[model samples]
Target: MYTRAEVYSPLQNTAIWLAAWLYSVESTDETVAALTDLGGRHSYGGQGLAALLLDARASADLSSHEPVVRLILWGPGQAAGLHAGSAAAEALGPAGAIVIKAAGGFSHVLVPRYWDDGVEWRWFEEKKRLPEPSWLSPGEADSLLSRATEQAAVLIEAAGGTRSDLPNPRLTVGTLADFYDTPGLPRGVTPRAAKVLARADRVAAIVETVTDRLGDHSYDPQLFALWRHIRTARMAGVADAVQDYRRASIS
Candidate 1:
């Protein structure tokens, strides 16, 4: 078992959480539209959302190991893969922090975490670079899965976390769509707006590929189950966001 301290160690204060969250967003135009509704018309868009998550995570007062989490979503009614980010400034002070993000596509999945090393967080703004996930074809997916599982086992041994608890499960399309509506979302989400919002599902593919790669690692089943639930729930809020967009379009 990975101690709560290990998972939550890095996120212990405002500055670190803020910096870590900043590194959590997608700044490139390729993934831009998919992440736009993340913070509505907020000045910073996805970057702003990361900052906000850090602030709120601090307010919740959970230890970094016992992190406070949020679910983010885009698209109408949350149509496609689920993702999650965990930020906890309370448990893991500055040097020991953790910030996470995830999305699923191509029947694959990924969840990424950043452990602070005192560097100001920077978004990966690269434009023409796309990573090919582990599972490419039936043959390739199997090979990648084997590699991921083996790597997960090694990581588990190194971290002292259980190998069985690391390999995340495969994601389905419907569950992926519901990833946005988090149980503890930060302020400024307007329910009425998501009803008409529309965004290209291009990012859906990106997330799926990521999740698939992530699933190659070992993960707790409970965590995977939560990912599914939160992933699906975001649609309700997304529905509202969609409606907001439609009204704006009409106006």
Candidate 2:
């Protein structure tokens, strides 16, 4: 039997992929179809990806020029590529962001708001000059991947390896397996970038799976440290993947 990673798309950050895809290509029927396929994975408030794209285009005049798209992945202690105290940065405190830079220096940042019902999109217009995102170089990306690999190993060892049965599991391995087994990547994504993204997705899945198993016991000092390590590693992998994807798209 094929491993879950082999069968799955390994694209965990959908917003990043979507933004990069939009930046790379024109809004054709194919683009819409691809968006629909990816957006269908999430539960949205309105008409989903189509509506979001339509609103963005209408409000920002995005069609006039191909906008620059940058993905921002933020957490409690980490806010890479975001200016502190800015509306866009504050709005995207924990959840990630997709920043679209249109003509005439118009910038629109889209942040996802998670509610009990579903996920919704929130747009914040950046009037002030936003700081340029600090992108990772190819070597930096490789270093990050190496760190992620080590962290993944540590997490797996600490979690006593993967468990098939856990009491009241929040996210089952099966569910994640199925969830990731979908279409991933946009056109023009380089093979290297795709590989990096796949590794990132695998590390992220490991983090989630192990965290679910720990449950309430995740607060244990040693376990918590291990969790933090894996989480940080996963974030690094994701950030590198995003940088690689952007580079591939632009180059």
Q: After superposition, which runs of candidate 2 have C-alpha atoms over 4 Å from their true positions?
A: 1-30, 33-48, 55-67, 115-118, 161-181, 214-251
Name the candidate that leads on TM-score: 2
Question: Which regions of candidate 1 deviate over 4 angstroms?
Answer: 1-119, 126-188, 192-223, 232-250
Candidate 1 per-residue lDDT, tens place, 25-86, comes to 22333222323332223232245444534443334322222112222222222222232222
Q: Give per-residue CA lDDT, model 2, range 1-251, as digits (tens).
A: 11222212222355445544445543446555664565443333445666776655555433433324555554334444666777767666344666666666777888776554445677788766567644454345545655765765575555653444664233454455345535655555545555555554555455456555444345234333333333333334344454555555546
**Candidate 2 global TM-score:** 0.63
Q: How high is each candidate's TM-score?
A: 0.21, 0.63
Model 2 residue 205 lDDT score: 52
lDDT of 1: 0.27
